[model samples]
Target: MRKIIIGVMGPGERAREDHVRNAFELGRLIAQEGWVTLTGGRNAGVMEAASLGAKEAGGLTLGILPTRDRNLISVAVDIPIITDMGSARNNINALTSDLIIACGLGTGTASEVALALKANTPVILLTENEEGKRFFKALKPKLVFIAKEPSEAIQMAKEILSP
Candidate 1:
């Protein structure tokens, strides 16, 4: 069977503590379930945190880098795709993963969420932003799910990925 890939999308530089913390737990849990954790693959913010969490849990991690800068790569990233596709790589992040969990909303994350929904990929939004929640939920009511916590998001992911 193919391994499930869980894309953890969030802010790279503007990620807050909650976003980082939740992304860590999400990555760890995803790894615990033998799923792959996919992220932007930078050494900062949510991407770094989630990758670290998955690596610590003995899970695989795939980094979809927007740039070719090897120095920007995260130490936790085992498989670096080195896209150099810039923001356009967001589409790859959204479409390639089996499911997407938006740990925190940002300009890039918003676009990724939309792309995922457009492709009918199940997305669980874990954000404290009411405006963002309202906006995304409005796009695809059936495909969008609002998660208040990382654990809850994982539970929802289970339901979505299960046969």
Candidate 2:
């Protein structure tokens, strides 16, 4: 059987502690389910946390980097694909995954969610705020799943992705 790839999308450089923690928990849960984890490959923010969590859980991690500069890649990434596509790398990240979990809201993360929707991949937004609630309601109905916590997001992904 082919392994499922769960994409973890969020802020790249700086993020709140809660966001980072949620991403970590989400990644850990994804790994425990025997799924692979994919991220933007940066060494900061939610990307780093998720990748590290997956690595620590003995799960494989794929880092689709936005630059050809290998120095910026995360050490937790078991596989690295350097694209040099800048924000356009979000498209690759979205298309390559079977599902996506958005840990935080940002321009880049929103773009990734849009790209994932365009690619017909399931997306679960892991945030509980007015912005998140409004964004979820604004999107196409039944297209994006919203979860209040990391475990709920993972559960929703599993149910949505299940054949």
Task: Name the best candidate (by lDDT).
Answer: 1
lDDT of 1 at 100: 96
Runs of candidate 1 with Cα error greater than 4 angstroms are: none
lDDT of 1 by residue, 1-163 (tens): 8999999999888899999999999999999989999999999899999999999899999999999999999999999999998999999999999999998888999999999998999899998989999988888999999988988998999998889
Worst 10 residues of 2 by lDDT: 128-137
Query: Using Cα atoms with residue i matched to residue i, what is each candidate's TM-score against the true structure?
Result: 0.98, 0.95
Best by TM-score: 1
Stretches of candidate 2 exceeding 4 Å from the true structure: none
lDDT of each: 0.93, 0.87
TM-score for predicted model 2 compared with the true structure: 0.95
Candidate 1 local accuracy as lDDT? 0.93
lDDT of 2 by residue, 1-163 (tens): 9999999999977777899999888778889999999999989899999999998889999999999988888888999998898998899999999998988778899899888888888788876556765766477557788888988888888788878
